[model samples]
Target: MKQVLISLLLIIALHTTAQQKTENVIVITLDGFRWQEVFGGADSILINHDKFTEDKKGLQEKFWAATTDERRKKLLPFFWNTIAQQGQLYGNRWHNNFVNNANPYWFSYPGYNEIFTGIPDTAVNSNDKRWNKNENVLEFINKQKGFENKVVAFTSWDVFPWILHEERSKVYVNSAFERIGFQSPTFNLLNEMQMTAPRFLGDGVRPDLLTFYIAKEYLKTYKPRVLYIGFDETDDFAHGGKYDMYLHSAYMVDQLIADLWGWLQIDPHYKNKTTILITTDHGRGDAKKEQWTSHGAKIPDAGQIWMAVMGPDTEAKGELKTKGQLYQKQIASTIASFLGFTFKSAKTVAEPVSDMLSK
Candidate 1:
């Protein structure tokens, strides 16, 4: 009887260890994707009239398919239909509400710092500030047992190495400036992309396409447990006041996101055990008729942001109709919970929002 009891305990311990080993999490950020775009289309949330065209009825025939949904379906069919249908998204309608200016600056670096560090800063005034990211959630997880070697970050933004403090040998971050392994074909393709895509005004512009390419390469080579891919094309296009470019970039991001999700399904290492979280660092300025070329200032709705999570652990909250606000800080805790990690930070973890967790 004693031997049997000991055998049962050993089996339970081994199973728990295996469960922990198999689970993985991926977080992807669209630099300037408004919550409006995530829930609906680009028609209604145009901060700039220049960006808002009447659906280009003619282009609908040439560019889009028969219906608006079908047209968008072609560009980012996974985000609009597949993930939303299978997962949960927030901040479009009244149901899933989120705060504007979650970070004081309402801009990229500050917002991203907040999202990864799980805290808000009231003093950050510009993107120019040299980012000093300390104790990012991923960094914390990397220090723990079993997660030390299974983490990575890829970003179109050149500054992400600073934002996440990836310069530390402990973190594996491959950004615009990092050298991908030269031997791999993926690395070769990425190098070609960087050469073709010029740096805009020395600020460093990484199109979503390049970001996706790097992520795909990383996944193929090293299947890290926690992966972050930051896409900056939408923000770049928005800053340029190129509304068409902005929308086109948004569509492109959607398509890539879909592809990554699908790839996970076919890959033996990731199938059935992985989770994905998609969100934006922040939103665009809420100018109904402005030139569609600004953020960081206090526009009426510019501060708002949105997020979506789809995984085996996520509960299916279909088409939320009520209004509720989620803060960027909650992301750290939510992600920790999803991976079966006991969140120890009282400062970071609140009761996991019921809308996000599996029922």
Candidate 2:
């Protein structure tokens, strides 16, 4: 009897410790941001663009009057003023930065796969394959004894189902051109909207607004500990060279982030414990001319990306000028560290960017 009683007490203590150390971490991927956007501020690109002509002069005026740091703060105001002010921003400088790739092709799928798995898989070349059977670090963590119900992912791209290996139902994901499963009424509505969403006027790309909405709704209803929201509109618009549309899409995403963060703050359970980790899979070119917006295999700048983090264990009003560079894989390791979870991927990068963590 005494042995059983001791075992129960130990189990209770372990459970309590796990509950206290756990945190809700949400990752938002901003598909194609130029490093210049964070480091350079608005320059000649704003002036020549017809759509931004009105705001161009004002932006220039503020940029010139402010210090370089201040200008950066202005362009990504929310990040510099709020998120960066509270957490850490990476990849804007030449300091101790280190870089690596999980795949030879530093494009979307490879980058994302590296991020979720902790290392790049050389064998995986394209996202052409319809399904991913490989286990992800997120999935591994979710299967652990204490974290069984905590991991979830929502992405705008149809490939995520395969990318994260959710096609087999191991992970929860809503992707693919065709709707595959059914859930609640709210999800049904979301499915209907996605299915019926009008394709872009000229090209046939499907609008991803529905995915964002579904992710938001899922967050509100499920309150999962880990959430991944991937937005592709900016990447699509950038590729189309629709400057106005690209900027608008980015702004809209910004608003959504503000809303998401606001909701977290107001929620009784997550208000004090949630962290928002935002980054991009890749970046676009430096050109802001006729070919201003686009990124891919041909563009060297496309491979570069940055990250911004905010929330619990993140510093308040802090900026990190790290000399050490990190690749996409570090993101997963950092998140696991924040959540007090053990990541099981053999390739998972264990080094957490310390500057971002709360002091």
Candidate 3:
């Protein structure tokens, strides 16, 4: 009887500890990044396109290389060096691993909707700046115990405020040119810096670097249980036919991710318990120079995208050079799983990736 009692007590104690573990989750969107450059490398053909680049020789010397792996490493060294080795990456279509948006509309609104709501709604066929009717995963998480008022979003595009349905969701969305308010000296400095920087498209989009700094300060200060940051320069640069700027933005975003992960490891609230899920709202065309800057229903495979997961509870599988496919709707469930929750998909179209979580 004594031995049996001891075993029961041990089991209960372990279960309680597991229940008490605090897991922080951060979701980042690269905004219309392509898997071609993510997995394969910089496109040699596109580098010399007169329409896309002004200094082909200079760009080539910096990002071009004899091999795909070599080029990718130079472009995104932190990702290839640290995240790839320690985390899991998917959507390398060349290896038959596919991840695509589920929404029929292969654009920002629908793709982001599918990602956050866990289902593709044909009703969201346009990128109109209207409040989203669908409920998002962040809102759902906020309703959960201990997560109320602890969910926040920082996005470079003003459209995100509508996508998140901030008015209805009450998720504390500080997006685009909207200030996040003063939390620290660093955040205040960024606020002042924003005043001096030139506004993009009349503040519909802010600089990606500014967004990163604001979100970073928010994470360090408030320690929100769930955070989402959307960086949009890649998409903007691509549309403007500035390939060099696009490439540089991609590299900068990687470093931002590295910095955030490093901070999480140092912060007591996030150390050893933070999980990051990085992905894009859409994928741009890359079949030709023209297609490289385009993503829409007409663009082939524009809905296809990629994702990376890193945390204490994730497998160290690195780049998934194998046969598999994931839909954007599955991301919400994946995020929930990272925090030890079993969330039923809002649309119930798919489940979380079984391999993404730790055993």
Candidate 4:
């Protein structure tokens, strides 16, 4: 009788451990968004600089405060107010909590490849439009029992199709100016606006707002188990030396995330069962101040990045201050762990960040 009771208790504990709260996962990326801005808010050197900021008084009034805490809240209200309260934020170097890219090249294609493939392939060194040979975690997740045909990506940059290898991976990718094929009033209006809208970033890239609305509508309609949203305005604006627009775009991205999270909480399929992971492809420079507009192998501190996670399965540790190191490559396995799977590939994949997972 004693042996039977112990066996029963052990079985129950195993069953409970197998059941994770995260049923759906959403991954978001902000291209070239620096950890400096993410942790410390608006930069004092760039905010009022005559070369970078156009409307110094207006920008300062909107994003500036005496304290870093207040300034970050003003710039990214949802991140500081919501994620900080409910999730974990990493990569504040001030506290020695660091997140960096495993890849040597601190650019878009290589950084993104490291993020999703979990392999910092030094061979993936260029931003040229070419199919990625590596197997991404998204494709692996799509092949899972319950996630088949339920993985999709919506991106503002056109290069994502090649980066994600949409053709080979069979993952549904709606990027750049591509029109939504869905037949509905909402999708129709979105298609029209996206097609006819002025191409501020050129013909290959659309505004992040359009990408958000389209992805949000798809989330409501198709209800993908795994969805990825890649916003590009921060990188583009910074490269153009438009600090005001960069700050505004970052603020808009935060608002969009808040809107999406609000909707997810009320929806029956996603409420309390969905996890959102947010990070950046790469970091920009800050040592010379002028180098903040560019990132690559030549730029110092470009490999530093940050990550935030919020979900039922993740503990509410808030902003992480303890000394630790995380890499962009770990994100692939981390996303898979949330969904109760371990990401694997022909290449050696990095291990997941165990600290982010619940005990």
- The C-alpha lDDT values of all candidates are 0.70, 0.67, 0.85, 0.94
TM-score of candidate 3 against the unseen true structure: 0.92
In terms of lDDT, which candidate is strongest? 4
Candidate 2 lDDT: 0.67
- How close to the true structure is residue 239 of candidate 2, measured as C-alpha lDDT? 73
lDDT of 2 by residue, 1-359 (tens): 99999999999968755654337788888777566666655545654466544555544554443456766655556776677666777777555443444355757787788777766667666768456545576777677665676677777676777788874536687653455354889888877877677766322233556667777888888778788887778777767666545555665676678778888889986887888888887776666444346555676566777777888677674555656667777777777777766566545454666666644
* Position 254, candidate 4: lDDT: 97
Best by TM-score: 4
Alpha carbon RMSD to native, model 1: 4.6
RMSD of 3: 3.4
Clashes of each: 9, 9, 0, 0
Q: What ordering of candidates by lDDT runs from best to worst?
A: 4, 3, 1, 2
Model 4 misplaced stretches (Cα beyond 4 Å): 1-17
For candidate 4, lDDT tens digit of each residue in 288-333? 5599999998999899999999999889999999999999999999
User: Which portions of model 3 show Cα errors greater than 4 Å?
Assistant: 1-22, 200-202, 287-289
Please give the range of 10 consecutive residues that has the lowest summed lDDT in model 3.
Answer: 13-22
